[model samples]
Target: MKYFTVALLAARGAASPPPPLPAAVALNSRKCRRSWWCRRRALGGAAGGGRMALLYRATRLKDRADTHVFTFVVTRSATREPDRDVTSKDFCCSHQRWAVAFSRTDASLGVYLVWRGACEGMRVYVDFTFTLLSRDHFTANEGFSGKQVRFSAGCAAQGRGRCITLAELTAKFADARGEFQLELTMSKVRTLYSCELRAPRLDTPPIAFAGFDWSVSASGGNKEPLTLRLVRLSGEGQRCRVRYALALGEGERRLHSGPLECVCDPEGRTPPWNPRPPSRILHKGVRLTVELVWARALAELAVSAAGRAATCYDRDKQAWALRCDTHSETVRLHMLYRDVHNVPRNHLRYVSWSAWLVRASPAPGEADADELPGAPFEHYYAQESADEGLMMETALRVEDISRAGCAFLHAGGELRVRLEWGDTYLLFQATYHVYDDLCRLHAHQMRREITALQAENYSLERQLFSYQKSLAYAQAQAGEPVGAEGTGRRSPAERSLSTDTEYA
Candidate 1:
């Protein structure tokens, strides 16, 4: 009976001419035969037409649901305890299990949506809204909302801190029984997929992440073990920790999987993969899949110190030198052979390094004193050779202290020197403190000079008075009449007074 039915179906299929297949379907006929959906379509097409089968497949691919909502309940006591965390049971959505956690710290409540699934090369971009429902489940209190929150292997949870205060949660969210429902509505959800591949030389293009272009490169071919590096093509300085899974080939043949930390600046790259055993060779076309599971930017190292200011006459240089012992913590840059190749050999390292003498806080309506151009001191860049030492020191100087240094001594303010070393920056500050002993010595010297000048002025006045009196007496002794001998001539006192007035 089965053979007879099959023969009848074959006769019917031959009786009617099959509709024409699309170019895509015709070219992939072998693939269609292997696919279950295509097999169903082929059976349906025997009755209907090939065009309907293709349309049906296309429609099914585009009709996937992209939105999901998960609801859970929590107790009011969870929001009262400090540093307490309450989590919901796992709920499945979009083939992934998700859970909502409420964390309480002091009086603030934080809401986080966590993904409980594998993060290997999977990134989910979602716009989510959190709502707190009352016991009646009728009135909804919106807790918080976030847009473009990405959940990936590196970052498994995304949420807002201080979404609601403990007082607000107690007053509005809980019911008479102290239980409340929390709803997480995830919308506009998008998924990005990444696949990792390892070859002797990288053949993949750069991928965009965190506003930078990142690509992989491999070095040490032939007999040497291969080293893979993550290179940043463009962007400012950034330090990120990358989690990746290393596999043997395109198949699920796993080899090793771990996290690699890297620091990359603009036009800089990082050497994170250094395979051991120097004899391990990577063939030209042999490929291994790597997954960029997680990535996070690391904060830079910042060190601040208070400086002591001093002024001394330099006998060797024969000049007055203003010295500031900033007591700064030394920051050393260790250069390895691998890292040296990534940085430029002859390039200026500092972006802006200058000394600024400004008040701690500017008065209102005054132009920001900090923004004013500072006294640019002399600086030079040092080049490193292959034979040079691995450690480098960063010591900047404020040379040629002239009138600016003297003014700074009198007018106390903050002297800030901002030194930029590649992507890292160091801010050295020195608050001016009047050297009490030096000021006293300077004041004593000025007082002695003033006393000598006052004494000389008194003696000169006395001598002038005596000379005028003697001249008057001699003129009177030899006079026919006081003004008869020379009518236009003036007295000695008058002449001296006129000269003094003209000089003044």
Candidate 2:
């Protein structure tokens, strides 16, 4: 009975429909509507709207978490089929906020640019998307380091899905004069996106000295009868290179010793200072050491273990350096050994800088020889005591202690001798603190070697893939009926490798 009455009432309701709603009321209820007032406002009050009629509508997708993604649809009033004007769209986001916003427009078609956030504050990762409404080519120009960079329709261009580093983007517009312009050119028309640049300054100061020092140190605390002086090779106030001369003995017997030259630039990419060992000059049985300590520069270098040897080895120059990196600066420690034949020239051998010197036994009559001393780690002091029991001493300097626990100097040990008629003795000790950081330097070198080897290994693996593929192709051509199942014959090269992996 209840079902029959319900059906009878539903039929009566369907027979008599409700009255139609008013035009204004119906338009107001829908999500979007065309308004003459809005069109007039878009025309800028009698200035006359351009040929392009604009309309814009926004739809908001809401989630349970209360977050929203607003998608905007724009169209032309005259045609409802499809709008082919927009080629691509990209947006940035940061700090839990969308970097772009849009407002509705009443004209049949509209184009707007919404931007926020400075280029300097841009994070390392940026998100962007491109929408291709047509097949026209687009291009943009950015100024960088006094050159113009053209970003076109191909790779690195704005696309459907893309991300870029802020540093890279900032570098592109680094030299822009307060503003950046993006140009989109088509067969029939051209559109543009221009915005003021808010990137950080990218000026690097001209090289200038922050500090410098040059001094001498002596062993045995004796006042030697020698003089050392430095002459500026460059002009006054110039700090690139320097020349020095040494003199020994006094009065008319004074001997003019080595006049050596060294280059020190505290303002260069790598400051020539303490890390760079002193120059060693062996002349007339006397050794002269000259070094610059604590120099400051405008730039720094990449740090390396084996000092710089692990990463950089120049066979022609025959020099080694160490580098350190900081947020704002990179520091380099450089050392140059003029005639070191044993130091490896190939970077691979120096990866760990594991090899060190061994103390060799002193040759007979070495104290009487006129030759300068050998490497510092080698303890080779000779003695010949006289009746009066006179004694002599030799102090050494080394980069690291040898296997026998002996120390060396910058590259070689220093030598000082006091001679008397008849017999005399020679003694030497290593300069321990001169290269106290040798162990640390070696450790860094090991790390660099490991990283480089890993990269090389990966590259070899990739190459092996190609080789295996070629081998598989040859085996298939041989008509051996190679099957995907087991029990297939293997090549000797493939069999040698223990891993039973196969490439098909």
Candidate 3:
């Protein structure tokens, strides 16, 4: 349960890759507020121009500053490290000013990032929502849906990076309209030292933000997503909230189907939709990539009773994530099948990636026609809008064009991974590959040389055996001239080389 609280809390604060800034980039977080939010205009799409929100200003930690803390309601701990599930009747997110930041003077990272809040009374205890442990390994959502946790949390200091996605949660949060009901109470609390809310974006190259057409595209310039993360405080007579806001010149939004997660107007009238994003991508410490592949290749897959499948598996172990592959005439697809493991609990294999061509490969003659002007192409992707978006462009060779959506394709590329431990971030490069003709040709030639060597060796042995027999017979005949039992005489061909020629 403690672990779950930690994970969930971390998951919400996760960040996407910040845009490229010129000078030394510092950790900076701002308030998520009505004014700082994008403003609405009469234009067709979004228009950016909103007031900027104040971020947590640097402050030194004073001696043992007054603080408050609380446990989560209906939360479950995981045997796994850095992950937890919490069930709370309600949870709230609010934007309140935090005076101090992470530094030697204040609370440490371990103490700062926890499920806690404070208030004014000398001694105060608030009945905020929290998850309680009952008996063994199971969990209860507490009549609510959505739970989340973070994994491998410790590192942020030594470059340990993190990315966490939480299942949707419902909490009682305050509104910008100053609604008292939504307003959590905190008073007389001294804001001293706290962990710096702002995190610097490592020179980590941004991975392709991938298909948003609602392939949403991020302008290397403006219109990027920004977010601020804060803590909530509540006690007998006092309460305060930390705020998070989205950033600009960074991330993107996508076309979505559900109601906006943001609060709406109270009048039941049209909500003030100040230039909202279709979707915002998280690309910071951990970069996420989605590869949409066809189903046929994944058919023979042995899905277990737990909805988990793998060509090979670990015993009684969770099979939520498995790397498997299938080669079909249409396209060979490799999948990272996931069970109900991820925070969102998506059913279909999580991150199913396969390579395929949308149109039949250009015919032999059409091959030249392909590079022709404006030759449109159908791309192999999961349910994507018309203009497919990709952070990185991948090139694939076409196989049979007449096949269904699921077809075998050949694709190879380089993978850059972002991993963090403590305060340090580690990057790894893995190159995905498919056999090329040159490699195959070299292999074939090696096989041919081996075969030729074997045959020549066999022939040489046979010739040596026959020659030995003939030489023995000739020597025996020479030993007896026409009838002598033991006299030896050299053969005419051998005589000149070993013995002097007789004149007579």
Tens digit of per-residue lDDT, candidate 1, span 93-150: 4434566654445666666676666345657767777776543223234666778777
lDDT, candidate 2, 190-282, per-residue tens = 111111211121111111111222333222212223223332222324333333344333365444434444444433222212211232222
Return the TM-score for candidate 2, rounded to 2 decimals: 0.14
Top-lDDT candidate index: 1
| Segments of candidate 3 deviating more than 4 angstroms | 1-504
TM-score of each: 0.28, 0.14, 0.15
* 1-504 per-residue lDDT for model 3 (tens digits): 233344456556443312211111112211211111111112211111110111101111222421122222112111111222211221111111111101111111110111212212111111121221112111322211111211011201110011111121112111122110110122223211111112243121211110100011122212344322211111212111111122222235322122322211222111222224422333432231111110011112222212232332111121323222223332122333222232221111112222222222334544211121122111222221221222212232223322344122212211111111101001111121121222344456667777787777556655765675576778777883332235675444444334463321
RMSD per candidate (Å) reads 35.1, 31.0, 32.0
Q: Sort by TM-score, best first: what order?
A: 1, 3, 2
lDDT of each: 0.43, 0.26, 0.22
Which candidate wins on TM-score? 1
| Candidate number that wins on TM-score, 2 or 3 | 3
